[model samples]
Target: MTKQLLKPDYIFESSWEVCNKVGGIYTVLSTRAKTLQAAFPDRIFFIGPDVWRGKENPLFTEDESALRLWREHVKNEGLDVRVGRWNIPGHPISILVDFSPFYNQKNEIYTQAWLDYQVDSLHAYGDYDEASMFSYAAGKVVESFYRYYLSAQDKVIYQAHEWMTGLGALYVQKKVPEIATVFTTHATSIGRSIAGNNKPLYDYLFAYNGDQMAQELNMQSKHSIEKQTAHHVDCFTTVSEITNNECRELLDKSADVVLMNGFEDDFVPEKSDFASKRKHAREVMLRIANKLLGTQLDDDTLIIGTSGRYEFKNKGINVYLEALNRLTRDKNLKKNVLAFINVPGWVGEAREDLLERMNSDQNYTTPLKVPFITHWLHNMTHDQVLDMLKYLNMSNAADTKVKVIFVPCYLDGKDGILNESYYDLLIGMDLSVYPSYYEPWGYTPLESVAFHVPTITTDLAGFGLWVNSVTGHEGTLQDGVKVIHRTDYNYSEVADTIKDTVSDFSALSDQEITQIREHAASIAEKALWKHFIQYYYEAYDIALRNAEKRMKKQ
Candidate 1:
């Protein structure tokens, strides 16, 4: 028999930042909150860490009576704490609980780390301690939310994001067994740990010290946590089919639904004259490239570009470099092609160390040495990114008018790179490449098409698969999006493809470029964010339905 669904009186979501700013998760949460609020009226509430304070920003200031009630409640429990509220869009209230007094008294590492973080924030990013505090603060918020927000009459569904808030979910689930619990991992802590940790941590990860590290950082064994959360919740949802398979294989649990990541399609302006837009974009990009490289570029030259976080092995930056190397090696293609690499990473940090070594004349063994020996290395300060002519003098590629430019820094506004220079590059380029080995999902190729440029993505990408299916049989699809079968993260394959694609780019006439633009625009219209909201609602419905079935047996 189909059980009656349990509609939640209130849905509470916890993350590092409710509205201020962070990464892609912040984008997901803020965008979804509006739709959920509209659907459920006053039932939606967001809980988050009260990281900063300001006049314009909303803050949680309880009324005098509520403040007394909280203080007395804390005193009765022999614990000291502070709680506030911040209002974000869609939700009328976002809880901000500061447990500095309680956390400091309990954990010495957390207290010292918090102090160190405040000082580090002024000069550089204090990621380690800031991450620790976020976890600690999240736990406090969960405890406080249960105390203040919970009621016997209320049916609450609490969803926590990432491992930072996993502790809060665990704490609240243990205390309020009656309330439904759900956990979503945007990216697994262990997955990132294994990616970033230079050393091997196989057996030792679950050992006392490793366990402590996980606890201090508020992480679960990626496999174990996801499995446990799946078991505890009525249903589970993950961002991609790739993640869903990983959860099932690693955690021994299958997701109830797959919720793909999406982008705001409306942000991209539309034009009926796509041919005009393509021609203008190309001319603008050439001018920007010529300015950056301190060399003149013709609009007829074929341009290829790649941009993302500066990690070499995972994000396929090295694959791109090797490809450019091979392309330039072919004298036939060398003068006609230019590749722009925009990977923003910290200048003096460990990740940046790779850039420094690659930039130096002193060469590494094989691939790392190739960039310095072959392509140009522009290790400019973040400020110098806008100055193209000066940035170009640092290149290793043969000092032709069209050569490679590597700018290793963060891009904030469009004027710096996006619209002002980066868009011009994309507009001018014949092809864009993203051969990521471990991209959870890819956005570069989709954005490439938005600007009326053709892109090459891997079969492994979720978006790539969708594009390939829609465009594979028709030659029109080839005009816009090309799916390259990346069997592995092999550098040689990347180099060969780079050589072939650049040749193809150089061979394309104005007629072909116009045709590609028309096809790409059509594809972009269907892949917008407005359509993705439906998946979010569907996942929530499943979660709610499962919660109802479990409650009936109880």
Candidate 2:
């Protein structure tokens, strides 16, 4: 037998929380850990911010020499304090960071100006100091950790995640020229910041806080530091082609390849008998109606659903609402349709204000189409919502047959709503709506398909673009999913599309519904975690190749 080619050692890493998630990066690290470990056990390592000790982490190593060296280096350099290590299964040496300097001051206003900048950052960039400071602190922490923790005998490769950890890889490479550095940007600063900004770039950056933001983007600052970090890395990877373009144009870094993000397979629930779940959901819906609206649902009404955070403009909540109003006014749909909205917002006083105004309308009557939005503001229990629905069904004011529910908050167990309730509602849904103006990639449509539920997502979403490319053209649109192209269109047209789509859905026969569900399930099975894992392997291979080339040159 010919000798088997030895696989190169690999290190898939980041500088964020792995098991304890602060953001999307955490999901990325945790989800792919097992697969990467299994494929390259001899050579693979997943590193992150090391921030635990003793029983807190399973890899509670008493490697006193490494620890002692790390302490000396940290003290000498006056580097911010963050310590912890958790080894990955299969991989002999895997780690995560726990920089207490950054994690501890997560809420502290390091500077009054920075705190002011944080608020502006939130509105303009959809990020806060937690992410901003982490980039700088993670870099310092990673650099210190490498100096003290790494062994000279060990052949090493480095991979950093997003802009936060990008600096970490660069710092390590400077000392160990023999090692190769890889940088992966799930989203670019320009892509997420400038493109996603509510205001025009010139207005937000140059006109408003131009001077302060300029300081923030200085040569030594995190923004510019991120750009330099990319330059120092041997290979650069982005999550999408769009992101690649933004990085090159904005950050001025050349990219080596694109590695799209993936989902975990196990998190997706199994497809069960939806009919039974739908029946229970309807009962719960009715009970909620009784408690919130003092009425009951009727069979004649059609339930339309939408759920997400309270970003009305970007998430298309206004677009959804406009469609609902138009659908409500349609003469043919007057008695046949109802809208169920679950977008979260300032449910407290704002919800009451909206309801009070609606209730005061001369045309308004008792047994409202939706229960009191206040129930959401109060953070009512899920069982409480169910009980309220049951009460509404018992009330004569509600038709008990009408189909509709609007949940104006995020669904969590503590909120008393299980995902099962949402899943059941989705199974019974006439349609699920998502018209996001700006989404890195949407998970809702993919999930909707897995549940055999039809959904609508805009071309703006990463998943939507992928699905359109996969499904449109050669096939008729009917397989339980319909992608409505927003294509940089106006608001009115979007509203019309939603209204028209709902009308079309109402007209579909049983055969078409079955086709839609089947298509959705087919799409989900292929697009889910099974397909996403390959990217990790490809990224790992590329990183190692770059590392080996460096070794040979030395």
Please, what is the whole-model Cα lDDT of each candidate in the order they appear? 0.56, 0.56
lDDT for 83 in candidate 1 is 39
State in Å the error of residue 383, model 1: 17
Residue-wise C-alpha lDDT for candidate 2, range 1-554, written one tens digit per residue: 95333234445365565434454555556656666666666355445544453345554343445446566667677563433333433323444444545646544523422332222222323343444454445455555555555554544556777766654565456556555577887665544444345544322322333224434443123454456666657777776654565566656765686665565556444556566766666655544544455543465445667776555555676677667656655554434555666655444433443345334423333544334353345544443333444543422234432334556655543344333445556656656788776665666666677767777777666667667667754223475556656644467888888787787777777788788878877877777545776655565556566766766777
lDDT of 1 by residue, 263-315 (tens): 55443545665556667767655554444333445765777778876656556
For candidate 2, the clash count comes to 32
Which pairs of residues collide in candidate 1? 59-85, 60-84, 60-85, 282-428, 285-424, 292-388, 344-409, 376-395, 376-396, 376-397
Give residue 228's lDDT in candidate 1 (0 to 100): 53
User: What TM-score would every model get versus the actual structure?
Assistant: 0.70, 0.70
Report RMSD for candidate 1. 9.4
Q: After superposition, how far is residue 112 of candidate 2 from its true place, in Å?
A: 24
